[model samples]
Target: MAGGMPDRNFLVNVFQLVDKDRSGAIDSRELQSALSNGNWMPFNPDTVRLMIGMFDKKGSGTITFEEFGALWKYVTDWQQCFRSFDRDNSGNISKEELKTALTTFGYRFSDKFYDVLMRRFDRSGKGVIYFDDFIQCCIVLHTLTPEFRQLDRDQTGTATFTYEQFLLVLAKILH
Candidate 1:
């Protein structure tokens, strides 16, 4: 509990409150209900599932108390990142803001890529990205970039793969 982080007791209380079913773990629905976006909306189910997948060390599709600390840190870190890039404080990230964030993170993508990203992640069809969607989008990019770099060994901005190889890559990442 250094550096103003919540103490272990506090984390345990929160975990207990969120684990409504008393199953000793927090599932996606429980996590989603417990979390709120910048706009005070419930977290997106997909984002919750993604986080669970990332931290569910037991492969139980749920986060136990032992894993809650890491999950909490992950969400708070993303919240800080979202606030920094959401310059307008509108509780949403515009395409331009997203581009700036990507650039700041050293992602050099084309305009078309940005367009496609916005379209795919704008679940509300509002032409802007809400907190949950923004998290999901960034997580996907963060997870895939290393794999892409590995495939593009020469760094020539391209990779050649057979259909089976491509499927394997996707399967590995998505799993």
Candidate 2:
């Protein structure tokens, strides 16, 4: 495969292995069980569901083999990204590491904002972001940045919105 992606046979084997129920697809639980946080911990269920929602083109709430290839690539790409930022190799991103990662991604946020992010994404309450939580955090930032920019017509890093407009924008993003 190009870009060092696993060959089709390897992917098929992995898909089959993760498809424990032999349902020809992998549900969130199956995916969660198959994934790890680089520390032998199961991936977060919420992240698994979010990923399934993204790749489940059929809207079946599961990932078919046909969809598995893309999902695999997505996870691997995120894995590389997380590892790159996890400089201490602790299998989790500390607040400082997260700050560095976000800054590198071109995000400009206040220390308070970073605190909020750490509190929100640090699911284990350990003041560190695990692999799945890190992915979720990055995805949120990545997805929202352009949407916010679209509203910030002057590029002043801020925008004004009516109550209705705010709801509409949030609705669009949530769906």
Candidate 3:
């Protein structure tokens, strides 16, 4: 709202969500759970079916971890690129809001990005992204982080991965 837009972590969030059993692969119910939980809306059978069609990249009817991962990256990147549109956090991001945010984020103009996002997330087609729409955005943000950036080969940035940018960041864990 204030600045351009803030991109949030999508895929990482979804991975934690859909992997309910912690097994990595998404069974039908798990994907349904993730989709439902992604937004605050009531779960409709038709919505679920449409989501399966959109998010399930493998056409497997169920989602695998890798497939989920891919979907997350695509969605999240789009969201990150245009998050500022949601200035009120009212679960609805308006088009003017989106344009302002993108401007602040350094993208002076991106008609294609706006068009595609509007087509997908704006269910009402009112030029605003709602809660479920935002969730879809987050799903794609999951894979935008690059492995090299994870290492920060330049050593200019922080050593630890904590914030949104660390969505795909690799962390060393101790057993």
Candidate 4:
């Protein structure tokens, strides 16, 4: 379940990259759109398929909260992620703040998709979320995420992600 994202510090990089509005969390459609169309690059069907496979934990054709949590464990210790998203720094991200984060990423998407993305990521309904609790949300929007996974795929083969891999991925999206 460990998606094997980069180390803890890298988590912020992913956040900043997807935080198009500088808000913290990412919603599902934003993730989809981002994948379909990289912020600085173009979108690719192959990349999108690969991504859906990576985050689609429930196999219900959509990503669920628990699925997103599994990804959070990859780049950070949940406690730390939670602390940051706790907006008021109150140990939790409020629903408004959470929506803000998703909206920041999903503003380009349809109203309906955005709604589903937020509802799916903010499972507890506590109105707020911890960064650790929104892993899938973030990963779905990560430009470098697929390469990150490839690097960690020592299981199938020791295919470490190198600058070459980064270039290849960028080429596909950018071109």
Candidate 5:
């Protein structure tokens, strides 16, 4: 949601690619198919469900051109943010660069915490985070932050929550 509006043609093309059935809209199955086929970074079903709920303003259960345009812009913005923080153009961001970038963007966390985050996203064990993992990390972090904060009310930086709480959080994020 950070980039300028995407071009209509580009959105249309993306929509067409995802909407393999030519039904003029994309459903969960189609989206999963596209992701599985490597047209996307392979989001989880929960993420896909959340996205459809967020972008399908008409409550149609399928995404149209306007919805897809918004989705595309969101992805492009994330990509831009990732590229900006990558720094060395290595197609990955080192832990140091990630720390600096997050700090520049006003995030503050302990070095240990940052290392944990970086390790979680560094799937290749190469001490760097590629774009796909970065995207997943960002999405999961973004979706969970509010609920995490709500549960961690004492500012202890950690909290115990029930399975019910987890489901509630997931539902909130998806809806």
Candidate 6:
């Protein structure tokens, strides 16, 4: 578990709440429902599926209590990272702040590249990254960084792909 999450009872309550079928685990349907409810933040089905796949250590097609704990820790860490770079505490991160945060995480993205990222994740059209948007950004960055590097073999920190190559890359990233 991540640091400072000493509230075991609270965690248990949340786990139970999410375990909608009382099956002692959370499946993809339940997890997707919880994430997409727009209660805390919004997550698309694909991202939620990837998240579940990441934490389903037993390969059981569901997450047990122990796995849920790990997921909680992971999300908490993301939240902490977002808060740290959101220096104004305005519940949003500007494009510049996002660029800096990603840079700190070792992603040397160009301004134009970051703009493309913003367009993809910033669905709210508010010109700032909210919690949900930030989560998706982190997911995409963590999951697709290797693929991005492979495509950017020239070390230019940016890659341009043909329509066919773009589809191929998208397929790789989503699955």
What's each prediction's TM-score? 0.92, 0.89, 0.39, 0.30, 0.70, 0.76
TM-score of 4: 0.30
Task: Give the Å shift of residue 153 in candidate 2.
Answer: 1.9
Q: How would you encode candidate 1's per-residue C-alpha lDDT over 33-152 as one tens digit per residue?
A: 999876666788878888999999999999999999889878888888898999999999999999999899889999999999999888878899998988999888888788778889
lDDT of 2 by residue, 49-124 (tens): 8788889999999999989999999999888888899999988999999999999988888999999999988888
Residue 50 of candidate 3: its Cα lDDT? 44
Best by TM-score: 1
> How good is model 3 by TM-score?
0.39
Total clashes for model 2: 0
Model 6, span 23-88: residue lDDT tens: 999998887666532335555666667778888888888899888887877777777787898888
Model 2 clash pairs are: none
Better of 4 and 6 by lDDT: 6
Task: Give one digit per residue, the lDDT tens place, for model 5 in 61-87.
Answer: 898887888876766777778778878
Residue ranges of candidate 6 with Cα displaced over 4 Å: 1-10, 32-43, 59-61, 148-169
Give the clash total for candidate 1: 0
- For each of the candidates, give the backbone clash count: 0, 0, 14, 7, 0, 0
What are the per-residue Cα lDDT tens digits for candidate 3 across 1-175? Answer: 1223223455556667777888766665665555432246554343344455566777777666556655555444544454446677655677667567546644444688777767766776567766555555433433233443466767554355556545434231100
Q: Over all chains combined, what TM-score does candidate 6 have?
A: 0.76
Cα RMSD of predicted structure 4:
17.5
lDDT of each: 0.87, 0.87, 0.54, 0.50, 0.75, 0.77
